[model samples]
Target: MLDINHIAKTFNPGTITEKKALVDADLHLQDGDFVTVIGGNGAGKSTMLNAVAGVFPVDRGNIVIDGEDVTDLSEHRRARLLGRVFQDPMTGTAAAMTIEENMALANRRGKHRSPFRWGITQKERSMFRDELARLGLGLENRMQAKVGLLSGGQRQALTLLMATLQKPQLLLLDEHTAALDPKTAAKVLHLTRELIQDHHLTAMMVTHNMKDALQYGNRIIMMHEGRVIVDVEPEMKASLRVENLLEMFEHTSGGKLDNDRMLLS
Candidate 1:
């Protein structure tokens, strides 16, 4: 469902602050594959996700989603093909909008909007209620409440629901649960797995938590210096421990894992 073909990206070219974010990074996902990404700081994990999402044009290579080459497509143009949940709960939803209002916007993603179709219809409200009810957080009862009033975990859960409202071809999760408390993060991660599996969606999740990475996905990939250094398939990943992953990184990258947040987590 997704193919990243030897993509590379550099920021502030020819300048003092120039940095190559992705170097020949390549990954392919089957229609229902859920892959977890792990890396230390500046390992090009988020860079690769942004590149695939077309946040900026890559200097070289192509990004294909569902067999369509979208390397040159603008970020908004790629929205129809991808659903994204960011690290910050505040980033995904409008604070001032009511729960249903925010969902209405998500439901219309990538479609042409008509000024005449301004209000939510009864059928649309019913659908939103059903979707919210699946969160099991009683958000269905708070459909009229402003999103700003929600707790961090609640808002994040709502954002996840909104992202998958239309089932985009690919889902990009960029450390989505990083900001939540451990208990909340665990709940969100569980919901994430259920949502992905239930919809049979293709997904790529960038996470700092090593155990979460290994425990959540069928495949795991590590990155270092803008390249994918290790990709553990299901057979290997099932037998692997966090310590094993650390050893693999040291052996492959010739450097010890230095990210404290990743290790301590």
Candidate 2:
């Protein structure tokens, strides 16, 4: 579970270029609640995610995860509690490392480590192979292959597996599929849904793709001007269409969606 209480953040607060990234932003995620977030540029989608991830401190309010107050925690301290996949496929894994090596690192996350003790056991290698096989990307057979040799889609998929290997308390997906082609994006999305459902993981995803937002999550939230403008629950969200969401955005935000960056499909 996650709780964000009236958190506010501003960049360059007193300067002429000051930008308010968050304004009393409030959000709560029940255990296993997968919520999809949608908005155009500067809507604070990524900013809000970073706040929860402790990329930077909020100017106001508290962030609590699983009943612990983590607003004051550093990013490295919070890393153990979250599994994150960024928009860039290359951000999550060590490209030079072999697939098995990358997975071994993820498995050991949040644990004490020493340079003297860094060998992968046969059992751990077997586990890694099984997990990779499930992706249907044939990566299981390529465990010894360098991650840098993988395609964008393959790399992103591997990143997903690495992120969830430890079964994090919450999963944060910031347009994880954004950089892939349509077919690859859809495949990753499908894999995302499978992983979340199978693990009963709670997740928050920020996406520009309207269809992906509505199609995947149990709930959909729209942000405008650094505030959550629309939150559609499961029942209502299931029947909502792109046009309907656009109307709701205009109604609640008092402005039309003039940005071309947000995909309506």
lDDT of 2 by residue, 153-240 (tens): 9999999998998888899999899899999999999999999988889999998888898899899999888888888988898899
Candidate lDDT scores, in order, read 0.92, 0.91
Error of 1 at 89 (Å): 0.6
Q: Which runs of model 1 end up more than 4 angstroms from their true locations?
A: 115-118
Report the C-alpha lDDT of model 1 over 130-217, residue by residue, as the tens digit: 9999888999999999999999999999999999999989999999999999999998999999999988899999999999998998
TM-score of 1: 0.98
Task: Please report how far candidate 1 places residue 148 from its true position, in Å.
Answer: 0.3
In candidate 2, how many clashes are counted? Answer: 0
Off by over 4 Å in 2: none
